[model samples]
Structures are given as structure tokens and as C-alpha cells.
Target: MAPVFAHGQLRLYLLSLLNEGPRHGYEIMRDLEQRFNGLYTPSAGTVYPRLAKLEEEGLVSRSDDGRKATYTITAAGRDEVARRQLDLGDLQSDLDRSASQLAEEVRSRVKGEAADLRAELKAAAREARRVARPAGEPMSGRAGSEFERQINELRSSARKLVRSRRTSEAVRAEALRIVREAQQRIDDLS
Candidate 1:
């Protein structure tokens, strides 16, 4: 994967953030994570050094309330932000594009995984049907149809869930739990 921020871009972006208002290190990291749509999370090693450098350059001033240090943009920081308005705009555009691409890739991967799961479930169901049936006897028509219908319903629901943009981690966890439970029940049959 490519670096999220180009050389010197993070420093400039951090300054731009401070230009908005005073912020602590954790808040800056959280803001970056949010701006990147959870695609990028900055470590303290990445952010704090840049902040210290900015303070050393007199671009930002810091105040400590004994617990944490809050950084406020200095006149120089605001001036720099004002001077690089065009760069900031470009950075914002780049971030938006990257986030969108990453999200699409995630969605595509999830769809593929869901399809794989469906295939595995179908195969397992077929094996189970074969094993449970007596030799020279066919499955009951109504029972087989109902079982296939339920499998199809599961596949359809999984596909829909994978495609939904608003699907949250909790929803995904519940879906996973259901899949696991179904797999466990299938194992119990064998």
C-alpha cells in the first residue's frame, strides 16, 4: 500500500488541523483517523515528533495542564496554512480519493468472502444430505425443497449485508456468529 501522506504533507496537514483550533495529541490522531474514514490511524510516534518539530520551529505553542499538553497554532502556523491553501485543498482531495478506493476494495473483498461462504455452505449441505440418506432412497421432495430454500435465503441475506454501506462492526459480528452457529450445527450432523 502507498503511504497515506506524501513527504512533508503530514506536517502541513497537522498544522492545518491546529489552525482550526487547539488540540491535544490524541485528539489530533483521532481526527486524522476520522478524516481518513478509519483507513489510516496515526501512532504517537508519527504525530508527536512532528508536533515537537512544529513547536521547535515556533509554528505552534503548547500548554500543559499537568495531565496533557494542548497545542495551539501560533501566528506563524496560521500564516503557513494561509500560504498553502491550495496544497491543503489538494491534500483533502487526495485523502477523499484514497478513502473511497480503500472502501471499495474492502467491499469487494467482503463480497468475495461471502460468496465463498455460500459455496462452502451449499457443499456441506449436499454432503450432509447424501450422508443422511439411506442407499437406494431419494430425499423427500418437500423437505429437500424447504432446505434448499433456506440455504438460498441465507445466501441472499449475506450478499445484501455485504453490499450494504451502512453495515457496522456489530452487525458483522452478529452475522459471523450466525454463520458459525450454522457451521457448528452442520458439524454436529456429521
Candidate 2:
């Protein structure tokens, strides 16, 4: 994605920066990185297209000075900048909330499937043992080894499930913290 969306609400800052004075593309990118303390030092490639999109959206305009083209904000762009804090918070909140719910749903489904697989494995093992047993072929040793191997596989699968669940939880937690605390900080600044 372009820095416009990756930086999320920072695009408003670009509009705000333009409100101060007309600036070239590099200037806008530099100012944003400075303002955010390098949280997002946008690349020229990303910023230029984003600027073009903003211009296409009627949020900004440009002028040529025989060298670098300077960009300026329109009234619509100013309104957009003014509303940035609230809109950004809402977007983050919605996204994080959705992630949290989805993580929980995945965790529940995996747990249910694990239970079903355990039952099926036990039934299959039982049926196999009952139906086949060569006379004095020493099936007991083979069955014991197979049982151990299957149990190890189950254990390995459970560990992977645990790791996946924990990783998702960690991501959801970070998103929630950003949505809650970062929103408040931006609101205070605005």
C-alpha cells in the first residue's frame, strides 16, 4: 500500500502541511517524517502517486515554478485535515475490533477440530486392533510403537496450534493498544 494509507491518518498531516504553504513532493515527505519523528519517512515513489490521488480527489492542487511543482491545499483538503484525528481513530478502532473477534473465532474453531480429530483417531485405532491380529505375529509391539508415534504427532500439532493462537493474540493486543492510546494522543493534539 501507499504511504497515504500505511501512515493512516498522516495523510491529513500532508494536507495540513500544504495549508501552511505550497511545497514540492520531497518537502511534504520530509515534513511528515519530521513531524512523526521517523515513524514513517515516506518514499518519493509512494508520496508522488498519493499526491496525484489527492489532486484527483480535489483535495489539493499544484503549480509549476519551472523546477519542482509545489502543492497547495483546497478548502476540501482543509476540512479533511481538520477531521483527521477523529476519522483515524474510528478507522483504527474498527479494524482492531474486527481483528480481535476474528482471532477468537479461529481459536474456537481450531479447538473444536482438535477434539473431533482425537475422537476419530481413537476409534480408528480400536477398530484396527479388533479386526486384525495375526497368530503370534507380535502385533502388540507394532501397536505400541504406532500408538507412541500418533501421540507424538498429536502433541506436535497441539504445540503448533498453541503458537498460532498466541501470535494472533499478541497482534490483537498491540492493535488494541494503538487504537486506544494513540487515538487519545492524537485527539489531545488536535
For lDDT, the strongest prediction is 1
User: What range of 10 consecutive residues in model 2 has the weakest lDDT sum?
Assistant: 1-10
Clashes of each: 0, 0
Worst 10 residues of 1 by lDDT: 127-136
Query: For residues 1-190, could you state the per-residue lDDT of candidate 1 as single tens digits?
Result: 4578878889999999999999999999999999988867899999999999999999999999798999999999999999999999998888788778777766676666556655765665665555464545665787667666766777787768756776655446656765786678776765
When superposed on Cα atoms, how far off is each prediction in RMSD?
8.3, 15.7
- TM-scores for every predicted model: 0.69, 0.40
**Clash pairs, model 1 backbone:** none
- Model 1 ranges with Cα > 4 A deviation: 133-190
Instruction: Give Cα distance to truth, residue 111, candidate 2, Å.
Output: 39
lDDT of 1 at 79: 95
Q: What is the C-alpha lDDT of each candidate?
A: 0.80, 0.62
